[model samples]
Target: MPVNYTEDAFNGLIIDTNTIPTDSVEFGASLTNILAYSAENNKGITWLTLPIEKSHHVGRATALGFIYHCCQAHELTLVHKNQPAQFVPFIPSHTVGAGALIKNSAGEILVVQEYGMTGYKLPGGHVEQGERIEDAVLREVLEETGIKCEFVSVLGFSNKHPYKFGKSNLYFICELRPLHNHIQILDTQEILDARWISLADFQRDAKNSAYNHELFSALFNLSGLQPQALENNKGAHKKLEIFFANHKDGLL
Candidate 1:
């Protein structure tokens, strides 16, 4: 089931190849070389190239589908030519990461400030090689916030920014219940400060805080859970129920 991109599939999407202004023209040349190299190394494999219009909107999906199909079919390369052709190397794998959407008894959201990163973010980190995503999230939350948590429900998945370390296509969003008192917060070097902010406060500060806004946006869309204002701090446990009720249909 090698996925091939047909011209008709990219009929009305926008892909501005001209926006990639590189002097060396290395992208296209490098892509070409990779395809050739892959073909020579993998016997019985053939590369397919398709011209993608500059105005295609689903480039990422298309590219993903192309790679998935090529890998499934044991093909070596699938190339896309816009103003310049780009070759995507295929590597099929999965990685685990954890995220916690924690709330206090008052229904306020729990957020932590990283030592060097501006703005408060939800407590989370990568799941180590032998750890489960939920367990990793609970450990990270405890280590970063000093609070043991009961895993409640999964929110959904997200694909993060591609970087040199590698690309993670899935992130688990979990609802958690704190099992300890909120004493004087102990700052882990991993975090400089932590607090529980009301959803109202989160909304008010989101526009002004880059970190708040980015995190909120990711959390909001990642689970497709409707944002709700908690009625009282006593009802923080209910917030997870609301989120799960609204988004359970799509949870992973």
Candidate 2:
């Protein structure tokens, strides 16, 4: 059977690697046919996704001019530009992280200190692939501080460049209500300590970062963004979480 593939809006083709033959010889022939077809049709680019089992074929594809694009889980995606100047592939440029600013009934805030952290910070971490921002913060809180919390709203976010891998970073501080007040450190390696501190003490403590203190203040003084329900008619994409002004009175 001919190599299974689909055309992209940019007149590019995305090859179905599952249809590729595992045999080296057959793989080469199939790749050649695809490339020839792409060139004749003036395709802008071609994307090839290879599963972990086909790692041996990576070198072969690279030798044919495929460049590493990105990787996830057990698969690696490579790209070849048929018309280099016509189409530019999108590169991942930023990392998204969520911090849980959790406060309990006792007016105490949840905090954690990572191994290298000089001051206590919120319990949080990077969002996982295909995970929602709200879910990410909740998971991070549980992972870092063994706390179960309810996501309230996003208090604020910080943006910075020159982060890991030269990519920009966006860190969102989310206000959360603690459902379980007890604190336990699940992973001792990443977390040095986890505990509850009075909000007053947190604001006055010299060991606490100013950034965290400001985030807490925002929770009480500012109306942070609230997640709004969104509907997607295009069934191809995943569910999206949209944040907008949480004003009770509608914005004119």
Candidate 3:
């Protein structure tokens, strides 16, 4: 009997594919239907994740050929993930991280470059258990930059998908004002160098790579600091222009 499938239900189709006998004819038909219906109906599933069933030597590689065919024949963008690179006996869930967005009196943004990494990053680290997000941000900033700073306001956080190590990270960005203006590495164990960069320079570096581009964009969006912080907010970085008739701080 040909398997019946719901119009747009994943469990009704994909999930059932796993339990079906791989040696049986139903397996091929089910997988074919999944690819065909996904291509035609725009099911919008990017990852065609099939269970790692070792019973019949079923692997993601087996599906790759069909996925390639789906792209060539039906013009679909699909990939598969199963039997991870290295099977971890056990792994943890998403991690919570906190970073600070601080500017110097000269309006330079603070960034840190790790030992083995290219380009600079905001001062941040994983939030330990029982630590408040605000506290974590302050601790990480001080540890990485060795600059004591006072928290101004809660900026926001970035939620990243699992890219490497099967671990996603939630990074909280907070507005901080430096109490002490000095760059000393308190945590040499983690960070190699720390420096303050001009906002313009930071923006260019962020947009340089796809990873940094998305990261910085997410940071600005999460912070909601300024309307001009979005991805389209390009062009030469301009100085602040406070327009007021009477209220003049005389500081740009």
Candidate 4:
């Protein structure tokens, strides 16, 4: 079953330490209140959206470190809203990734075996800084598997649930038009293998599949995608119109 989570799921405790004026006493007090609230309320997670002042003189980093330490001590879940991508120096952190659903001429889906991952997964990876979502999808695909592809419409997104993903990861789900027939694993150190796999084969080996089976199941069913129709790549080259439905229809 999909984890039914939403923003409202939490008794949102927005800990904004930025409002504290440039006073040492005030800063210390704010920090104390944050830790106390979290320690007292063993439930709600803390969403930190503090100011970005890393200067040693300003002591913003030190304040941020205290927030971090408090969460660690209380075993409280933390959401670094100020630093969604961690592209900046240091505020808190969140990762953004892009992935593609690439189907081949045989209609088989493309999957890659990662060095640390089990079974197989869609050919995609972390989006580089300043990279567009579509570009990131194509770039990651080519980097992992030397297979060029054309951009198709996106198939919504799978927001990484903190419980499953550990941190907040907004992953884009894109439909890609493959240009090459052969897949060449370029990054041998990071990638184990890349190849086409049939839906039947994927389903049959679900027992031995990766830990992301629930995610794939949610992807296909939520997107209203038909695996049975595109199971075989026996026809001429044609553009596939991917069907999409909001995966967060009910969960979000």
Best-matching candidate per TM-score: 2
Instruction: Give residue 57's error in model 1 in angstroms.
Output: 45
**What does candidate 2's lDDT look like per residue over 8-108, in tens digits?**
64578999877977887778778888988999998878889899998888988998888898887788888888756743434477888898877677777
- Model 2 C-alpha RMSD vs. true structure (Å) is 14.2
For model 3, residues 1-252, the per-residue Cα lDDT tens digits are 443444322211233333545454566666565556656654433233333442342443265432321222222222432222311112246767777878888878788887767778788877776566667788889889889997655566678988333568777677788997799999885687899877567677643456665555555433233212244445687432211222245332
Q: What lDDT does each candidate get?
A: 0.54, 0.80, 0.58, 0.59
TM-scores, one per candidate: 0.47, 0.60, 0.47, 0.50
* Whole-model alpha-carbon lDDT for candidate 3: 0.58
Off by over 4 Å in 3: 1-92, 163-168, 204-252
Ranked by lDDT, top first: 2, 4, 3, 1
Q: Compared with the true structure, what per-residue lDDT tens digits does model 4 show for residues 49-76?
A: 3344412213443455423422332233
- Model 4 misplaced stretches (Cα beyond 4 Å): 1-93, 161-167, 207-211, 214-252
Output the number of the lDDT-best candidate: 2
Please give the ranking of all candidate structures by TM-score, highest first, separated by commas: 2, 4, 3, 1
Which residue ranges in model 2 land beyond 4 Å of their true spot?
1-91, 231-234, 237-239, 248-252
